[model samples]
Target: MKTKKMGIQKHYYLMMLPGMLWLLLFSIVPMFGIIMAFQDYNPGQGILHSEWIGLENFRYLFQLDDSKQVIVNTLIISIGKIILNLIVPLIFALLLNEVRSLRYKKFVQTVVFVPHFLSWVIMATIVIGIFGYNGVVNTIAGWFGGQPRLFMADPSIFRELLIGTDVWKEFGYNAVIFLAALTSVNPNLYEAAAIDGANRWQSMWHITLPELTPTIVLLGVLALGNILNAGFDQVYNLYNPLVYSTGDILDTWIYRLGLQNLQFSLATAAGLLKSAVSFILITVSYVLAYKFADYRIF
Candidate 1:
């Protein structure tokens, strides 16, 4: 009987082998290139034969005048996106939950979710068309006697644009998880609250929100890991030299350094720093989630 059970489970183990191998080959193996971060990496000499200069690359990164600004931009944009992503989705989900009309709920959900499926490349064009100097936004402004402003070129508004567009793109997708959590909540709880003199708002505030707390905390923890990633594709597609002072994040800076300027080692070092910081953030977030919310992602 034991042998039969073991043989049955062996196929399950075999089913997981391909994915494990893929992760090893693609993810784990490439991490070995991190050694290039500490070296004066030469393509002709290759990684193994390249000259090692410990911490020099990191020193060079900080020496650049734009480096601090880039780091600040990344954090500001990412953190803003993270907060808005959670709040907008939660509010939308709560509002949608209140709608008794299933047809209307589904229609609204579908409309909002369509944006998430569109690639950033396509969405960037749409965003530019709407916010350009003579675009739809300026046209609307003109109707109200407002001046035409160069939104894309303005450093002051670039970060706001990044955050707003990212939130608009992803809020619906994020809300789906909250909506699912809403489904698991027992309807009887709502009924009980009503019998105890609770109104719809009171029921939602007391029963619905509390039930959604664990899921919120778990997703929040996961988001903390990406605090340094400020949507490279969107920024790259929409940004210009005029806005680079406020809009350039770590990834864009790295691209220009490594690809355009040929500072391979410096780029690698910057990337390695980003990964290390993200890992530490994720680990700390997981620990806090477990401690505070009794939520364990793993």
Candidate 2:
């Protein structure tokens, strides 16, 4: 029996070998480049022979006006997405639960969930077409005797547009968790509430919301880890120089610094700072999740 169990475990370990090797090649190997954050990285000299500069790159990063603006943009966009992603998905799940027609519910879910699978590359093009000067939005405005406006180029509303579009794109997919949580809610509670003269609103508020509190808390706490990750792919594809003031985020800024401007050391320093902060946030979020929601990986 022991020999048979050992054989089975060995097969499992073999299966895991490919993934472990991939991680080492891509993720673990790249971590060695973190040394560049403290050095004046030179391509000819490479990471090893580069002049070590300690915290100078960090000091320069903090002094940059562009860096300040980028940080502000990242926080604003990320926080907006987090808050709306939480509230909108929960509301969507609650409303969906009230849907009695199974076919209609499934249809609506399919329509919304489809966008989540679509890459940001595709979605950015669709979004540009919709918000373009000659697009549907401006065309509608022209009907109301309003002048056509370039919605995509307007810096004032850029952040709001990013948040709104992200919420629309993801709310349906995010709602799946809440919907799953809703299933575990006892139908007896709803029946009892209805018998005591509770309306749909009353039942949802008093019974459903309470039942889903732990899930809501758990997801919200976990989301704190991503507070710095303002959608790089989406923003990178969509934003232009005109919208840079309001739309540029840390990832895009770092990309431009390293690849575009050839400030490799500065970019690495910025990336290191982001990684360090993200690590701390992730640790704190996990602690909070464990304490408040009784959530744990192990």
Candidate 3:
């Protein structure tokens, strides 16, 4: 078996050469740049000559109030997004599945999916037009005897707005996965339940939901792995210093520290920390998925 495996390995390696080269050049080579996080890295000093500070960069980050806020905001935003992301999409998918009219079903699905394709910069402009102080939401609220509120400016509401917008943008794309899972469920189960006098709600609760558990669990685990990444593009586009207390996440914090403040070493350290946590989370999730949920992407 070992000899045969070696023979097949040669053929596999030959076929995978180009892709392997791409990964090496693009992914692996670039990761070596992470060494800057451990050093008082100077661009002129280059990688080898930079003064090594060991874990000083990480320690300094933990000592900073702004850094702590970044971590807190990242977790809060990500968790909020995760909950909303699953919920709205699941509800929409279930509702869409019930629609009898093919034309309306297609139209709703298409319209919902449109936002997923839009860039966050463009979406930010749309959000401003709808949620800014004079925007649609405040305008509607004003008509109801409420004062015009700054939705984006208020730190308390920024997280909510971020999660809501993310949900709106990504829900349709996520619904596609659920819709596919729903289609694969055996119709005979629904039929059997119907014959046994199960109503629509009962059949949905018993048949449809149980069939969706594995898929739900699978996606839940994947989302959990990404719980620190609250989205750079969205937050960067939508946020300002006014709401940074609640809006600054790990990625955005790094952007300010490195790009804006020119503290490249500190920013790199923060990024490396996030990447390390994400790596561990993803690995653990994959293991659990295989052991209990049988989640296989391929």
Highest TM-score scorer: 2
Clashes counted in candidate 3 amount to: 0
- lDDT for each candidate structure: 0.93, 0.95, 0.91
Q: For residues 179-260, what per-residue lDDT tens digits would candidate 3 score against the true structure?
A: 9999898989879999999999998888888888888888888787888899999999999989999999999889899999
What's the true lDDT of residue 104 in model 1?
98
Model 2 lDDT per residue over 147-205, tens place: 98988989999999999999989999999999999989999998999999999999999
Off by over 4 Å in 2: 1-15
Backbone collisions counted per model? 0, 0, 0
Clashing pairs in 2: none
Per-residue lDDT of candidate 1, residues 191-262 (tens digit)? 899889999999989999999998888888878988998989989998999999999999999999999999
* TM-scores for the candidates: 0.90, 0.95, 0.91
How much does candidate 1 score in TM-score?
Answer: 0.90
Q: Which ranges in model 1 have alpha carbons more than 4 Å from their true place?
A: 1-21, 290-298
